[model samples]
Target chain A: MSRVLSIVTGANRGFGSSICQEFVKFSPNKEQHLDFILFARSADSLKNTKESIKTLSKVANVIEEYGVEMSDIPQVEKTFKDCLDKIEWNKYSKICLVNNHGTLYNLDKIDTFTDFQHIQKNNDINITSFVTISSLFLRKVKALPNFKDLEVTMVNITSLAAIKPFESWGLYCSSKAFREMFSNVIAEENKSSPNFKVLNYSPGPLDTDMQKEVRETCSSEETRQFYLELKKNNNLVAPGDSARALAKLVFTYEFTTGQHIDYYDIKEK
Target chain B: MSRVLSIVTGANRGFGSSICQEFVKFSPNKEQHLDFILFARSADSLKNTKESIKTLSKVANVIEEYGVEMSDIPQVEKTFKDCLDKIEWNKYSKICLVNNHGTLYNLDKIDTFTDFQHIQKNNDINITSFVTISSLFLRKVKALPNFKDLEVTMVNITSLAAIKPFESWGLYCSSKAFREMFSNVIAEENKSSPNFKVLNYSPGPLDTDMQKEVRETCSSEETRQFYLELKKNNNLVAPGDSARALAKLVFTYEFTTGQHIDYYDIKEK
Candidate 1:
């Protein structure tokens, strides 16, 4: 039987957890065994996700849970390396890495960003750790035996802010752009590897805590009103709905490598 | 008599120094008294640029030189704040900030990037320090008396890498994208201020130490050959020529705010 190992970051709540649950619903084949490794700020935080996965799939097992502080660069490196080392590479024919963890620094004009420490912390979490983990993951997996036969998929959870600048979202927009471009570079570097794929997925403005933060703290009154109206009009996307689209893209693998695919861009059959 | 205060980073050598020399050549009018503040790793490093500016325009003066380590976030904040506090805001009717300081991190494939410390350092220099200095400059200048009457221009020394991904150029490309998006947000935030403008300028391939680094350290043989061919065929741009075009863009002020103008995009008459 071919086995699959999936690793997800920020897999404790909202969209991250939803991706875990939704991915299982799409993969019910008795011939394939599924294993999961979840990462969040604390293993305890992933309890609900672990329970939900158990309810969703009897064939899927939550094999590991890592409590990680993404801003701690050294710790992040060690943790990711340890996870890869512990994995039995020959046990799985397919592997997927979801780089989904991120932080919204603040909702303020760029000129008003006065806290240097806060800015550094944000970059460490959003940019530095993302690069470190992704680089490490790719290096370790490619070194495995039968690498050419094993399927590898890398997904970057991106946003509309990655392409368009939003007022009072200076840090968030720039970090998303950085991730999307980095993913593009990865796709370019691995173009000859037919078994390798990269996807930049924008989950849309989901009804989550992040949206609530945006509505409350956005410096521009107009932007704040826009978010509030989206919520009021029921225009915000559900986490499960967006996650299903992302899973469909991952499983179908129809995208041109390095393309930015939005939740709204997906066509349901 | 109106005065212009222009602060430039990476002003010790290469394209940074060339900008200082070329900007002086463009502002030969005696009616516009020009004062400069140059930043590099050491104040002594800026001696050549200072002398070159003096030879170009008798009306231009090197007002200050700051020795800065861009990777040190706390020190960057302090140095930029000190520079702003020492400036006589009432003495200048126009202000310009050129965020030109940057480093070309090693050209290696994304998966082969193993040095976490190096990655953090790259982010600190390219993204964190740029944000710190630009924020301080904008906040300090906008708080001055008669601020609306003062013309302000902010220039980001960007590259084609800002929009395109190249194999083995992952970090460099992502950082440039981050800066470009951040510049776009600044434009969005300040759209109401008719006197405020931002420019993201791509200088093209220049005959500088950075291109030499690319020719030496690029991991991909194909990419290395591309740069090598540019140098061999005498196709590399001269720093003075590109800097002159940038000076024209800044002085003529014909571009839309936050527009990315490349060296080749300019029409010379």
Candidate 2:
């Protein structure tokens, strides 16, 4: 049985976990099953998640997971390399790597927040690690004997914070913006590659932990009320919707790669 | 007599030190007298530079100096506070801050060069610390009742890298871009304030140690030839020219506040 390799970061919960679930459901060819590589910080939290996935999982291929903090700078190469060691390279012809992990730091008053620890944490996961992991695996994919047929996709989860000045979303927004520009260059440089697909995805107004913190800290009463109303209207998107959108993007990877793919755009598509 | 107060960051060498020299040379009553404050990482460097200034330095006003590393996040705040602690607040009405520091990281393969020690160094001084210091000082100016007549101008020294993507200058370019955007917001938010001025300035391509390193690093014959041609053709700018250009921008600070003022744009003015 040939293996289809898929790696999802921040896969313990939220959109990352949701992405993995859809990969199991919509992934083509059960006979050429995908070996799911779930990367996250918490293994215990995933124990409960595994039970739910067991019920919904449609693909017969086995799930191989990595319990490591992608944000931890020193461990990234070692951890990701270990997973690659286990994979049977010949079995996989396509690699879909989704980087859904993100860290949002609260820093409206620069003087009040000069904590390097917080800055280091945000920079590591949100910007540097994405580049590091993508570059590492990209070289590997290119070196593979199945390189000609392989579609090496790198999808980065990004935000609207780049365009709008969201209060206290400094670290998060800057990181997202960097990712967008980074992916743009990658796409341009690899224009001729038939199977090389790199995408920057804006997940769009999710009712997630990061958003919850934003609502609490924002100084503007009007902005806070607007978000609260937005959530109440169920105007906020669900992780499942993003997951489905991503799955669709991958299946139609030919059309969506290289540009920034927003969840809002998927609705129109 | 009121003291003329100013602070210059990255004053250890090059345009940073030259900027400090220009400030000291601006004759009291030429516009207004200023008691200057100099900031850099080396106390010894400032001491030697101080000798040249003592002759023309304001007779009655004092020039206080400090050593502070911008990378130490908390240390910037402490350094600024230490400066503030020494100054008799009642003596000075006008505040001028110059963010004139930049750094380059190891240039190598874009995909493989994952070591970010140099990137972080640049961010600490050029981007993060600049914002932190400016944000704090702006609020202070707003908070003080005596500062009603005070005009506080923050000048961020940006580079060509802010707009262009030079292969070897990834981290430096990204940080400058970040600084430009940061100052843009500060300007927009302070649109109503006549006294608060946030400015971004590119000093042009000067023959600083940084530039010299860039020239030396292009050891390849093809690339070195291109740079040699650029320099010979009068394309390269000198440090003195950049310093003089910035002085004019500061002289016309009231007119150009909250906007980009490039040394390259000297002709139009």
The C-alpha stretches of model 1 lying farther than 4 A from their native spots are: A28-31, A267-269, B267-269
Q: Please tell me which predicted candidate would have the highest DockQ against the true structure.
A: 1
Rate residue A8 of model 2 by lDDT: 81
Q: Please report the candidate that would top TM-score against the real structure.
A: 1
**Alpha-carbon lDDT of model 2:** 0.68
Candidate 2 structure quality by residue, lDDT tens digits, A108-198: 5332454555665566667666766766776677777878877678887877765454444555555666666556545654566878888
Give the per-residue lDDT digits (tens) of candidate 1, residues B1-269. 87888999999999999999888888746558889999999999999999998887778999999999999999999999999999988888778899999998879998898888888988999999999998998898778887998889999999999999998999999999999999999999999998899999999999999898999899999999999999999999999999999888777777889999999888364
True contacts kept of 2: 0.09
The TM-score, computed over Cα atoms with residue i paired to residue i, of candidate 2 is 0.85
